[model samples]
Target: MIQTEIYNNGPVEVAYQVYDDFYHYKSGVYYHVYGDKPSGHAVKIIGWGTENKVDYWLVANSWSTTFGENGFFKIRRGTNECEIEENVVAGLPKSSGNIIGGFIAFLALIFYYMF
Candidate 1:
């Protein structure tokens, strides 16, 4: 038998001073590691990565593709640069179109199986 354990912890409050500092952005990578001051804004962590032996996290931004890496950017991992790991939000898969349409499709599947 295989055993597994899960840990569920709440979000953490982090500080970010370089919220508008995009000049440091290059090739879709965000390397802002100076902002020690706190900001009221927030971001979400989508994934993680390792480049040149440096761990980092893949973050999504609201600025759209015009921003960095088609609206996505990478930050140094572990240290929680720009507070990317703190106050994080998990995104859900978007529905096809509308709730009614999804419901209708679900019902059709159920009916087809029953009849």
Candidate 2:
């Protein structure tokens, strides 16, 4: 789960318009605008970065990398643009059969020592 501020300007509706639908032309850092409103939209936070000593957050978009900064975009850090800074959640990685088997073996050894 992710959080961001209200898209009063409606990001999904405005991003294309702002970039003019030009692929490979939208490459740059992004910033957040602070205010009271929630658009109920979600975007994945890919990474973090800093330019010229300024902080920012990296966002991943469905549009191909050619569309925007290698399929990613930067937004203002710490401001929670569109409430992005709030209520974030990530899932644990899936375990493979081999890993589970190894864990089970380790547990068995521990049990043997205790008994």
Candidate 3:
């Protein structure tokens, strides 16, 4: 069920995702009803399905992937997720051979959404 890959063997850096731009909202609920992102903020970039020469950068929503091609929404690109355009941060590290630590957290978050 997991399609995304996380590379953290090298230096840490923000995702230069295949898509462009990022979406941001003030605050909201995620999943069916489990993870309450009090942080109320996240950056989502639609995974331009494989095959397309140039992929599209769409915005992800709480809506299930069933809604769209894979539960994603198409929003304009070049949009800023928030004001302070802070430096990007690497995602889902997986180098130290001890990725389990991060994977566990990832699994917990996933279960929270599923349950």
Please report, in order, the local distance difference test score of every candidate based on alpha carbons: 0.50, 0.48, 0.34
Q: Write model 3 residue lDDT over 13-63, tens digit each, in one string.
A: 122222212223222211122333333223344332322342233445555
> TM-score-based ranking, best first?
1, 2, 3
Candidate 2 accuracy as TM-score = 0.47
Candidate 1 clashing pairs? 56-77
lDDT of 3: 0.34
Per-model TM against the reference: 0.50, 0.47, 0.28
Ranking 1 against 2 by TM-score, winner: 1
lDDT (Cα, 0-100) at 4 in candidate 3: 31
Number of clashing residue pairs, candidate 3: 3
The 10 consecutive residues of candidate 3 with the worst lDDT sum are 12-21
Ranking by lDDT: 1, 2, 3
Q: Pick the lDDT winner.
A: 1
Name the regions of candidate 1 deviating beyond 4 angstroms. 1-17, 33-38, 89-115
Better of 2 and 3 by TM-score: 2
